[model samples]
Target: MRSLIKIYRATADRVTGRNLDKAAARKQLRILEEIEFVCIGAVAFGLFLEMPSLCSAASLVAFGVLGEFVIHRFHVRASKREQNLSDKESNEQLAAIAEVNLKAETERLKRVEIEERRAPRRLSMEQFNIIESRLRAFAPVEIGVIPTAKGDAEPLEFAADLCVLFRKIGWLPAFATRIDHTIRLGLWVELSPNADRLAQRAAPELVVALRIAGIAVDQDVSRPAGGEFGGTGEEKERACGAGIILNVGLHPVTARGY
Candidate 1:
């Protein structure tokens, strides 16, 4: 009996391998054990009823096959149930993360409002009019300003000024501040993969414009993680969708430029 148990365990290990789903495999093994017992009982009962050896063997085989079919159906259903439960849990986690992000956004907005009230207006109406006049030749585009840290008002202020300038030139501009620790230096203008040709062409010009406005700006093109251009220690930023992602970094006095 011990030798048989050892053989069974060896066979199970060989069949399942190292990467097999243990829970599902164990459930299937249990079902197989139950089927083995049922087959044995059916064979014994058939023999006790004076059935021929051939008839008993056929009955055992039929019972085993039927048991396997039923157990297989149950196994499939069980796997699907587990998968659904996993998906539900994952979705709930995602929703929770989104809620947290929303709350953080709300807080950032409040800070921005406070900052706007406290920080004296830097650009006069006449200077803004001149920027608007210069931007008249270029078509309008939506711009997003993302700050790298909370309460870092320099980037937010720069974005705000750009927003005012762009709005004056009939462009849509929005800003969102986030607490990202990766960004260290000059402001980054990230363009989306499917960004319009006009936007792509205007991106460099916008960078130049920001520099001329005394704000240090650079184009940020992040490579895919684990790719040839990606560094081992670098955290890849998520891609912006169909527009521009402006990453606001720290002021020069706070951190050195990269």
Candidate 2:
């Protein structure tokens, strides 16, 4: 019953020159379709009256073919309208998705900028535990913590964190002392030429522990020039346990090809 009703309505629309699927087609295009229907009907009527001899047969056939042509044209134009509408909708959806992705990336960059403003140089308790276990045999070894002079506060804060990590593991790490040095970047563990076997073994372990804790420290190439850890005049820093000194230089570089 519903199909019959739809068929009846479609026929009625063609006879009355009504617009087809107004919501799916543009207003001007629908008006043009309606005008075509009216013109076809008028032309068919005029041909029927002018040819009285074959008006009932040949003229009727001509009108039927012209009616089919009009319906075919309407369907072709409606299909084009629907395809254009779908393409427009698809483009809008893609543009919206691109905007959302760009905004998320901008927010991520802002977060990175804020994180770079301050150094996240401290270790968590879990990191401390990992370092402590790695440096277990090196306990009771005294370590001298030294910060480079004319450096920013980040290195000092990093040195303080290092001292805390050592103290929690039963080691006597010295108070942080600042002095000028030729070294300008990164953390280092001192290993002078005169150091004994115990200091030699323990220094590398400390470096490994710090590296495991996500902190980069150098033990290799850390022996001072001329085998002496000296700097500006009258600067005498403490030394502990076979000359093991923790030198905190400038903050670890982020992008030196490291």
Expressed as tens digits, the lDDT of each residue in 3-78 for candidate 2 is: 4434444433342233334354666466656766765665676565565666565666566567658765876766
> Which structure among the candidates has the greatest TM-score?
2
Tell me the spans in candidate 1 whose CA falls farther than 4 Å from its real position: 1-134, 219-258
The alpha-carbon lDDT assigned to residue 60 of candidate 1 equals: 67
What C-alpha lDDT, on a 0 to 100 scale, does residue 6 get in candidate 1? 45
In the range 1-258, model 1's lDDT, one tens digit per residue, is 334434434433343223435465556557755765675666566555565677676776677667667766666655554454444445555555666676788899999999876664354565566556655566566555555656655555655776677767765555666565554355556554445555555555565565455544434334431111122333333221112235222122222221
The alpha-carbon RMSD values of the candidates against the true structure, listed in the order shown, are 22.1, 13.9
Clashing pairs in 1: none
What's the CA error at residue 20 for candidate 2, in Å? 19
